[model samples]
Target: MAHRPDTLEHAPLGRDSAYPEQYDAGLLYPIPRAANRAPLGIDDDKLPFVGEDEWHAFEVSWLNGRGKPIVAVARFRLPANSPNLIESKSWKLYLNSLNQTRFASREDVQRTLLRDLAAAAGGSVSVELLGVDDSELVPQRLPGECLDDLDIDVSDYTPSAAHLAVGEVIVEETLYSHLLKSNCPVTGQPDWGSVLIRYKGPKIDREGLLRYLIGYRQHQDFHEHCVEHIFTDLMQLAKPEELLVLARYVRRGGLDISPWRATPGLTPPSPLRLARQ
Candidate 1:
């Protein structure tokens, strides 16, 4: 309970591939879910891509069996660069598989969850059970300072109108998250999460940083792909001396995707809550 609900807590008919508003199939009230549908475009050659990466995760969730709805969060670490980046919707689907499971033991439940999610993700995942009674987990990193509490300003730059040429920015470790929740302009779904950005470069324009992030307000792509595109764009325009970009999402259907990218030699800082994977 130390984190948000694992159930699909969005307004029904949102943009998940299977349950879009277009489907008009009614809301997924009994706890919606997903997995592995996001990574489909990973190796697209048309995009002036950046680096390669691997994704690992340990996700957790379960049915109360007691008739009461219980929200669960599993915590685990992923390698900084594993070779298995997952497809997001597939992740939602995998987590939903647990919707009907009646866990007999918390330990057994945790073990099974880790195994299944890892397999579905095409990578290994870890699971740390956060009891059903726990309070929703909010970032311990901030409160009144949280971006969720602020009025955000949109970016002035156009993503389609690149900066003409590539540029780079370098800076010490710093992390930021926003609910600016943007979805694929094409699909119109909400992509939620707190993104962690760390790098050592010539220093990026903070406003530009904000603008660049806003550019994705209507952009469409998977969580991993989005981060990679951003990383690639910045390295070309800002030309950072060194950089690492990561996005750790809150669970959507008992599954969460945390994507990390670094320009070799730069060690991305791991949140104490995250696994060292």
Candidate 2:
């Protein structure tokens, strides 16, 4: 189905919802990416960057072949060009449906999730189930300089490109800040996160960049869209030759969303959880 801004009103967000007693793929809501991309001058067929929406479900559980409870964490990688983005709350509900359902094995659960999520996202999605002790799931800090120590005054809390400025010095560096905060457009609840920005081109004014990130404190949007907005804004304002923007948001409803968009050939950084996640 095509996405419209108003379609979110029908999704299982903002309103109280019932938990499903059985596995129901229909509970997953797909919001087409075009609806939000249109405002940013992005075409679904001609995306500027390649990346993925890495989702970690921390409260995943299901019954085994013998009806014994099993618990594991799940990581889902959704392509950036996917036709649709699954609404977070609906994703949580869909996972909850599996709590009482029985699976033959972890492989079976992973296969089922891959099939359902790929279909919902309208693109190939990778699903991996990890045991609680998986070493790869360890928390790590975002690699780069932290900008939160900047003693700068700020008043604007709205998203704006005006705060972004670039210097003539060509450089490649990674910078990050933990001050990223935005609101959910549907529920008005806050979404807090850390953001990493890596680029190669004219030097981006650090103070201006920090101000630009802090500007999202009062803005409202989804995680994926916010990252895309930042990517596009920097591409236009700073004219970076190469750029990557990733945000690791704190988990809500037992799930965390980390979306990254990068230059066509640049590899995405590891999807490690931050301390706050």
Each candidate structure's count of clashing pairs = 46, 0
Candidate 2 structure quality by residue, lDDT tens digits, 92-188: 9999999999999888998999888988898899998898899888899889899999999999999899999888899999999999999998999
Best by lDDT: 2
**TM-score of each candidate?**
0.57, 0.97
lDDT of 2 at 239: 82
Please, what are the lDDT tens digits per residue for candidate 1 over residues 1-277? 0122333344223444542212111221221112222233333323332333323333434556574534565555444233344344444545555655666667766776556545433355566666544443433442112333335566442353253233353355464656434563334666776555665566655544655666666665556657776666666666666766766555544455666677776544444223211
Q: Which candidate wins on TM-score?
A: 2
Write down the worst ten-residue block by lDDT for model 2: 1-10
Instruction: Note the Cα lDDT for every prediction shown.
Output: 0.49, 0.92
Residue 257 error, candidate 2, Å: 0.2
In model 1, which range of ten residues has the least summed lDDT?
A: 23-32
lDDT of 1: 0.49
